[model samples]
Target: MSALRRLSLSGLATATAIAGVGVSTAESAPPPEPARISDVQQAARAIQGMTLEEKVGQLFVLFAYGPDAHKPDTRNTTLYGVPTPAEVVAKYKPGGWIYFNGRGNVESPTQLATYSNQLQTAAINTGLHVPMMIATDQEQGVVVRIGPPATQFGGNMAHGATRNTADARTAAAITGRELKAMGIRQDYAPVADVNVNALNPVIGVRSFSSDPQLVSDMTVAQVQGYQRDAGIMATAKHFPGHGDTRDDSHTALPTINHTLEQWNTIDAPPFKAAIKAGIDSIMTAHIVVPSLDPSGDPATLSKPILTGVLRQQLGFKGLIITDGLEMAAVRQQYGDAEVAVRAIEAGVDQLLLPPAPDVQFNAVLDAVRSGRISEQRINESLLRILLMKLKNGVLFTPFVDPAKVATTVGTPASLATAQTIVDKSVTLVKNNANVVPLNADPRKILVTGWGVSTTQALAASLTKRGATTTVAQTGAAPSDAAIADAVAKAQLNDVTVVITQKAWDTTVTDKLAKQQKLVKDLLATGKTVIVVAVRDPYDIAYFDAAPTYLATYGYAAVSMESLAKVIYGETKPTGKLPVDIPVAGQPDTALYPFGHGLTW
Candidate 1:
């Protein structure tokens, strides 16, 4: 059989296998077909028409602040006083632009669309006339780049609670619609990692589930829904699986200790499924998977992994992007120029968020001139990128009006849709004393915790609904003064509501320990204490004494608002705990078992 025939058969076989059916004969299977041969020829011809500089520029994806207000400090400019986005575009003419934040307010979808159009216009004005490939990390749930009012689909854990592929599709479709409206053509999402290691600090809730086949199915559905329904290119991310490791690559390189056979069975399934589904791109992880390439370099700079495994063995022809080059995983280990050259040699089509674009660009330029990197290789990557732009319908069209952006982007109806998803995704766990809905009089209630300060809007929302609320933060240690403050308020009220917030920073361990002690002290007062975990449910192991425990899964403003509404009988808690919370020191038990939640 031809390679194309085999690839097509493999894709069909995998899909059918997922649906629990078997292919009887090769004659019954169809071969994989490329986009019209003429389209490929036209793209190739366009690439041939480009100058060497233009080709090289197309391989660099520069980072810039989005029009959104909450954008992260790109650190390249603000921390170091480097050139701004406009300056970078004028100087580098990068192939793509990644929004760093400050693009627009996610709270208003219309604003998001308007901001995106303005940024794209700025890029086009650089004289490249290239419709800049705009990208964002809109991986629904807790990692949402856009606000909750835009998309209700929480994180992967929330989607996994449904355990239905169709649910994943629906979430992806909504995500695609919102992204396209904002002029975002590419989304780095549907984290294909399988949540195999419970101790995985970074990928915990971001992953769908531990089951390989299920992850594969859901990933395919997400990619398909985003591209087919919303016309946004979906990139399956952190490739080769970041799920099984405990450390986060954002800080350092994580090593995956799996043999080829093991990876093929476990870590590689979702990626394979994604490729088969025609995912537009795949982002290389910074972790080292020794089984595929034992040279000790991260997968982003390993040819055996990027070219040998992904491109040749897996037959992935789409663009291959590296995770942010500025990440400690890459920067701390490799020099900037060397990393750039090595990444290109390893078959990466795009270098994301390069720490020093000038240094990296010069390095690649010198490498090509010195015969260290081939011109053919550079052309190969540029062609793939151009194909992607053409496929997304960006190469031919001029920029759309920012005014029309709001009309297509997050509409009032979309925000309401997001709220509905949040309402359904909030799970109720351990209501032994029937403490929820606080059936008692509104005047007799005291709410206090670290979460209250961070989620003041939620507290205020509850207050508006007639719940008398006294909010206090739990100190670093459970002290007599802190206990007195909490107890005194509880003494004056009929119910004590304790909300605990877990920080996203490295202080999570120390902070969790402190919150645990505070919860214990609050429970010792013999008052009816309802503990609300406004972070991961894993924190529940600290306060077993509380008769009622609620896992809100996240601390986003909308999530907090949803939590408050559920507490006052204004909304029902229908979201189930997406992860299992094992007893402290238990191996299989999560802080709460996966799929454990109550609806009222």
Candidate 2:
């Protein structure tokens, strides 16, 4: 802290201080050896004295859940009459924690700091005094887990829509700064995946652009901004690229058929740039690339890709983290314990959110005891883990002031920065027939549904814009019959706004049929049918004949509000298509390419 402070002070003392830390200092006024050594040097000395159990503990990063965010993997069992995840920290003393749920079940900022501090206090109680790294997958707008009190920046696809790298940088800086202030020093973000595949289920708006160069440039800028501006470690993720695969790895194993050349040209540039830019961590994708490893193993468990490509070929010396091993991608085949051992053998430095953390930890421990995994391998990962803690300032600054949380989170400056990104990223993809800048009255506007919650979310945003918005009369679930009813109500409105959302890339026959029916019926009435895509922009390809089309790239509150504001001509739509939306004739390319957007 003093080193950073002194560097800011303008004086000859800077040179004096520099000379003091030099290899051979002046004999007359040699700097006293009373202070501490560098984070790297300190980490090196600390590891030598650690026990094998303690060292192995640092290899795992497990999830700690808030009440409302509990999933199948979260520990639901109570401990000491408390429903909190406090017991998990005490039992494992793992190297890190993944904080889910920034909304319900999470207390106010001050209480959140207290909870984090309490966890840290329990972790260091083992006498090793090691600090645990707290992290989140705060990938901006769409995948934001931390709620109010945190500025939700417009996501990566939004950044790409603006074609502005600085927007990406500033949003990341704000996110990282606030996260750090709340005791989280790491974020898994700035998705390096180039969303080249129009039907990519997982990497849609979370990715920056279809163009590799644009993704690479924006990725590097995001890393720099997060680390330099806010002093937090930003991880470049889904490495070896999870962009082109059609399957969602959360439920299935996705495959990328691209050869090494294709991977190098399209998928590898961002990882290379991230490495060169001093990114602290790199996350492995669970997808399979047969060209990289013919055994059909996913990249997370493939030695050739993890060791040969990422570490040896790419020259990334930082920590290598695996995507959540609990996902069906790896879990369906390899049991909890077995895959954990394989992941370590694959050259991964950390196992992220392994299902059954105890089972996985014990599996690796047994592997070491049986000589199946060597102590040397353990040392290599241990060294990286310890160094990361030190270099990222998690070692000395283990605790944060609970009272100061209010001043750091969701400040006016951060929210303003977020609104700027939103304002710039709400894109107008197609406005044929001048349907947008919808009539100033906007008194009788009908919003059709896909997902009821998302429909209501967009309706709320429209309502804020002084539009009399009504959710269509769709049944419990979106179906052809339900959409038929919705179309009947939509025809009564002065203008109908149909908001579409798509997630899974496969088996959408029913959805496609319903959407076609809904739009056809509404258009038959001769009322203006305005299509606003709240999710992936590619859904536009299914209904290209709609008189007007727009892409918000997300359905978040900010994204919806931006979409509504643009419709009212209150905020100019500046965002362009981050990915190509193919028309009827053009098969593989975008009808609207990158850097194409409009305003009325």
Candidate 3:
């Protein structure tokens, strides 16, 4: 029998007796003092006893299709060859599950907790009887998966704009606590990349700052907040850095051309600080850095970068996780069957979100049997994953009380703290005519923006504050009709507050060009116009003619609430630019330097 079977059989009776489910404890006795080994020793023995298949399964944190863990998933029945999540767990016995909001895996707090418990029950009853590491990308801000009923905290750039590490710490703690309540033990958060490239398509508002030290300080604070404060594993992601790239790894392979010295100066500090602060995991980026490894392989498949640089030079002893294996960056480089094996050979501890879990699982198992990967190598990673699960309280107590999820998450006090963070981050970069703190009684304000939800939220908040608000929703790429309607609305209103959104990876110039046209036409109406870059602050550089400007760094509900307060003169705008605002055509030149902000 495997070590997993041994562990499960040995503890089954004890677990049943503890629950007082009519099992007699009188038939069992405690193990001798020698057998009362440390967690590390126990983990080692368990690994020693596990079969080759069981060992390989411990290396993956895959995704399953479903809202209810027990119910059949008709949509992915062909892909998984299984109906329910429980069946998936029985077949693959993965180390954990990664939830994505876009996948409909998340519905609400209690619902998610119920789903978590069902999965845990299925997972614990399987091969190793180990509690799976349940996790999500609960980075807050725009990247949040679990929406309201959970407090919306500001993203990293918002924290950087406030220049407050305390806010970063608080946001992480609250995020961690809420996630834990929903039975998620890990958070892929506190993006450590120092966004130095203005044309960076991926890590704009997600990154804290252009300065490495600021990013380092913020990363450390968030790590402590997530791990120490709320007792969840915090991940500092895209190691070696993904901030300076002009392309996104989700769709294309990005290459970072920094030399060894420049990388050490720019992208290395935050990761180093994260390790020093005892971050639980560091996620690999799918970008290639030729100076670190001349192999031209992405960091996710580069041993010279993962094993040589991240492990040997940086000395990160924690779990090394790969970014989603489904991403085109890694997939285009290798087949689905070969990618997971390559990642393991390259020194990654956990393969996350593989496109084909069954294929990758068998591939890794085949590699070990073929001598391409040794059993000893698999055991090394198993120990790290087991140790992490043990240390984070996932080993012993895996199930959570769904009853407590509502009260524990999205409490009024937590929401208030979230508001404070966004409030501090509401940056006023321009108030050309001192037109802000609008003094008009029964103020006629035209709220127009790229997102209908965001514009509606702002309009509602302004109405609550006694302003007669007119909402003309101009989408990201506003049509001629939308622009004309917005301009007509602006003429009748005293001030026009246009919220423009240029997402992190937005490359199409025509859409943004049209949005800029809407802003210019609003200005042509001789109306007081205030522009707010709600996503990436670079939107203002594209439409620089606006007399008044603000950057919320995000369009989260709490961010909109704070923006309303700043607009109505209820609160002062104190946030500075965490990144320099680059001129639209000039990626190298700055239109507004870092730390530019105006306040009443």
Identify the leading candidate in terms of lDDT.
3
RMSD of each: 10.0, 6.9, 2.7
Q: How accurate is candidate 3 locally (lDDT)?
A: 0.85
> Per-residue lDDT for 216-246 in model 1, tens only?
9889989988999888889898888888786
What's the TM-score of every candidate structure? 0.84, 0.88, 0.95
lDDT score, residue 310, model 3? Answer: 90
Q: How close is candidate 1 to the true structure, as a TM-score?
A: 0.84
Which is superior by lDDT, 2 or 3? 3
Instruction: Give the alpha-carbon lDDT of every model.
Output: 0.72, 0.76, 0.85
lDDT of 2 at 2: 27
Native-referenced Cα lDDT, model 2: 0.76
Give stretches of model 1 more than 4 Å off: 1-37, 65-84, 102-115, 122-127, 440-443, 451-454, 473-488, 503-509, 564-574, 589-592
Off by over 4 Å in 2: 1-38, 67-74, 78-84, 102-108, 451-454, 473-477, 503-505, 584-589
* Model 2: worst 10 consecutive residues (lDDT sum): 4-13
Judging by TM-score against the true structure, name the best candidate.
3
